[model samples]
Target: MVVENHVPLQRLNTFGIAARAMRLARVRSDADVLALVRHPDWRWQDTFILGGGSNIVLTGDVRALVLKVEIPGRRLVHEDARGWLVEAGAGERWHDFVAWTLQQGWPGLENLALIPGTVGAAPVQNIGAYGVELQDRFHSLDAIDLETGAPLTLRHEHCAFGYRDSVFKHERPHAGGMGLKGRALITRVRFWLPKRWRVELGYHDLQRKVAETGITEPSPQQVFDWVCQIRRAKLPDPAVLGNAGSFFKNPTVTPEQCADIIGRDPHVVHYPMPDGSVKLAAGWLIDACGWKGKTVGRAGVYEKQALVLVNLGGPTNPCTGGEVMTLARLIQTSVYERFGIRLEPEPVVVG
Candidate 1:
């Protein structure tokens, strides 16, 4: 258990925002988590649960205990002819775990190769890329209720996953929902892998990459490599620079709205949604407004990836992290003005 106060979160989050936490605690085991939750001093205030801080924006000082979920363990919990099942400690670094699985010849997690953040945060977003999502292979999870400190098991239905959201993120806490406010904190994630893989080519980019290779059957590693290569070219590394992977979730709208946008701008990309809706590429809207690589001062859009917002150096807004908010508002306004569609931010912002 590591405890501290007035911890500067700039170095912690990928956004590099200079925010402060009144109290911060790191837990490496379920016991530590329970202890922290039961701690008399911590039980009375609003708290922020942190993992890798990849998808969070700290706009101001957090006057609460910033509990970082660090419980660490990984093992093969089960295996069968259909697939080998693996369980991961929520606190484990996600990308490293994916690499470990790849090394072990696991087939389920290959397409999620280089995504940043902790394993715990994966289910909050039902993280997807290329043609696969974490939920597609998820068996279930173990989460501790923050209030009662009791361990609860949750299956896929309980997760309420949607595009870039789950009950943990989009919905309110156990208000008959899966949000992690008072009664939820993920501790373990279970996966079901395959003995023989089915190569998912649902996404066009993945299909095009495979088409170029002139192969129908590709090894999991080959598919993984291709996805990684594309991500490398398209996404900026948040380590060298400061950025959350994607700044916004691609907005979903009615087909009629999409058709109207397409009529005006022929290049607008649209992915048909299941229930007669369409998901638009936010990158297209941002690029359409010529916002890519555009910056005000300290905050800027990533040069390579239009979806990413990077902090250049010094303080941006000099006020309310307004510069960062400005970048967000610009993308929102421009997209709305151009296509009448609003791009929603992906990161959780603490104001």
Candidate 2:
């Protein structure tokens, strides 16, 4: 474990917000984590596990001890006629892992290509894209309890995965619930990739790619390339323009509520889920509210995609997390007033 004081975090997070962690610890292995948790001076300190820093907004300097997960490794744990089981250490980049799996003849993770963040954080958010959620391929994960310093192995059902939600995202530890939240730090994740892989071309963008390329039977790498292409066109590169992709979750509503909104606004874009709920396009709603290409202080909505909130001031004078939240609230209020639906932010806000 390497410990540092007053660590600058502007470049650590994709938002490029200028903030500092009073103390930061980089743990390269489970032994490092256990050592820090068992240390007399640091055992009881409030802590935050930081991965790639893609899905967070730092409001100001953080007082909690920051545990920057840096554990690294990837390997094929098992393979059989049924499928392949692969495991990766928590700190591996998500996109790189997806690509590596494809190269290893595992095709199940292609739909989630190009997403930013580390492998460890994927389960916390139940990250999904283009019709595939992490739960669809998740086999199990190993994490350590911060309170007791005990290691835990949880399966798919134990995660309580929902739409961009998991037990890991909750704060309270319910009696029968896996509300891990701040209590657990994931150390590794395992995925079960089935032998029979089918193309998930249900999403409009994927369908468009299939139609344009005239490749009805695309390989996993082909699908991966296409998803990357589509995302690159819609979302801004964090290196150039600071942003946390998809600033808000797409609010789901009942059929009756959907009908009511449709009556008020005929051109609303929405998709009917497998269940009865209707998922409205948050970007479309924000654009409808005239937020695209607009700014509030140093934070602004991305011109290409309103769903993205960007730092307009660049690195020198970057947008603070406060500015981003302020703009988010204003957009939320306008959206609610006009459409009677509330917007929930996707990224975790911290200080």
Candidate 3:
């Protein structure tokens, strides 16, 4: 239990937003995490569990105890007729784990390649890319309760996962039924990946690349490399300029709303939502509003990828969330003005 005070959080998060934590503690193992959880200072009051910090915006100095989950280790628990069961620590870097699984010849995560954050956070957002999502490989997880010092095993169904949402993100963001809101910390995640391969050529960019390159027999590794390359070319490196992956989530619209928007703007990019609703590309919408390259203070939308919001340069702090929200507001206002659609944010805000 290494506890440091007033530490800068820029490097911890992929966004590289300069946020400060009053107390930052790194838990190297489950015991370490439990010891800190038992600490009276944080047991009864507010605290925060942070992984890679890729999917959040810090507004200001976080006053609560910040637990940087460093618990590590991974194992391919089983391989059978069905698939490979990969269990990873909550603190493992998601990309690293994805590559590791690929190296072992297991597939399924290649489509979600290069996504920043921890293995734990993947389930919270049901992290998706191209035509794949976390739910496709999800099995179960062990979450520690912040209140009663109990551990809860949440199966796939128990998480109540949806698009960019889960129990921990939605109902738990404020507080949930058992008074366990953000209180449940995912300590480990079990993923079920296929032993065979799945090459999703559904994303237009990938298909375009496949066509241009004439790659008919794309393996999982090839697909992963391509996705990583495309992502690297578009998304700014958090190691350089600060930014969360995507500020706003693609908004889901009703059939009528989608029809209206599509009719009004012929170029609007929309994917059919699982519920028969339509998921409009927030990036396309924002870019259409002429905000792709727009800036607000040091924060602005990524020039090439409209979904990404980057920090031009600013004071070290967390309110990066607010800055992004500003752009999101503009996007929402403009889209509503143009097509009557509302854009929503995907990151967790710890205001």
Candidate 4:
């Protein structure tokens, strides 16, 4: 119920962008959100929900009342022969939750280990990695309707999950679907980890780990460890180098489009989808454009992985969100000009 003014946000966001929130509140429970919505002085429509701050780019000082979700808890809600239903608070760290599930003998989320952001934010972005997505294990979620202060429990169908997308990502209703965007604040999420656990090593990196370790039938913990190792090696730790993980989502194209791109550059990395579409690696395109280890202002493309954009200026002199976007625009333009595919940024850009 307490709102603070002029909160520093440099460390809150993984990108380490220098910004401030005009008004901020830490949401710890359902009651906290309800109280804020019913507050006569505060308008619910003027609020913004923020979670782990791992997947956002703050363009400037935030004028909206920032609800920094800090709700916490994790427990086994139910169990049956089919699966285990696990629930976690919206604010729980995603990686920690994934590890906790594995330790509890629930193995469905091992491949999603080491991803940034909170559990609540996971569904919002439909976060995926190593061939496993949140939607694969998602059961349901509890959220507060910011407009009416009513509690809501939404299932997978209600979320409309897609590749790095969900109904929560849209601010306006489109295609006969109502968008929750700014009108909802997730409080808790439940996941169903099936008893029939199966390892997902379809990603090239995981396959390589299986090959190198000679552990073809790796356990969940081993998969978790390998994923953590692979991520640590490929991504810059936010604590050390400011970044928002992969800057762009891999673009999916039709078979003909893929063939055209292949004809242009025979070595373009891509994967065929079950739906008959082809997903091109965004990093390879950027690297092929010769952007690796390059910089624009204080923003640079990670030399090891071109999909990631980094803040070259350390904490003492951080890169502004403007600089980051500038670099992203340049990268997008380059890739589009070369391959005729438009690259879309994955992070939610907020000003």
User: What lDDT does the true structure give each of the candidates?
Assistant: 0.81, 0.93, 0.81, 0.93
* Every model's TM-score: 0.93, 0.98, 0.93, 0.98
Alpha carbon lDDT at 59, candidate 3: 75
**How does candidate 4 score on lDDT?**
0.93
Considering lDDT, which of the candidate structures 1 and 4 is the better prediction for this target?
Answer: 4
lDDT of 3 by residue, 130-164 (tens): 88989988999988876677888988768777778
Candidate 4 residue 58 Cα shift, in angstroms, is 1.0
- Once model 4 is optimally superposed onto the true structure by TM-score, how far is the C-alpha of residue 225 displaced, in angstroms? 0.9
| Residue pairs with backbone atoms closer than 3 Å in model 2 (clashes) | none
Clashing pairs in 3: 15-243, 18-317, 58-318, 58-319, 59-318, 59-319
List the candidate 3 regions with Cα displacement exceeding 4 Å.
171-180, 314-322
Give lDDT: candidate 1, residue 264.
89
Q: Model 2: number of clashes? A: 0
Q: Give the per-residue Cα lDDT of candidate 3 at 119.
A: 92
lDDT of 2 by residue, 1-351 (tens): 667999999989999999999999997898988988898888899999899999999999999999998889999999999999999999999999999999988889999999999999999999999999999999999999987889999999888888999999998754357689878999999999999898898888898988898999999999999999999999999999999899999999999998998998889888899998999999999999999999989999999999999999999999989999999999999999888889999999999
Give the distance in Å from residue 83's predicted Cα in candidate 4 to where it truly belongs. 0.8
- Which number leads on TM-score? 4
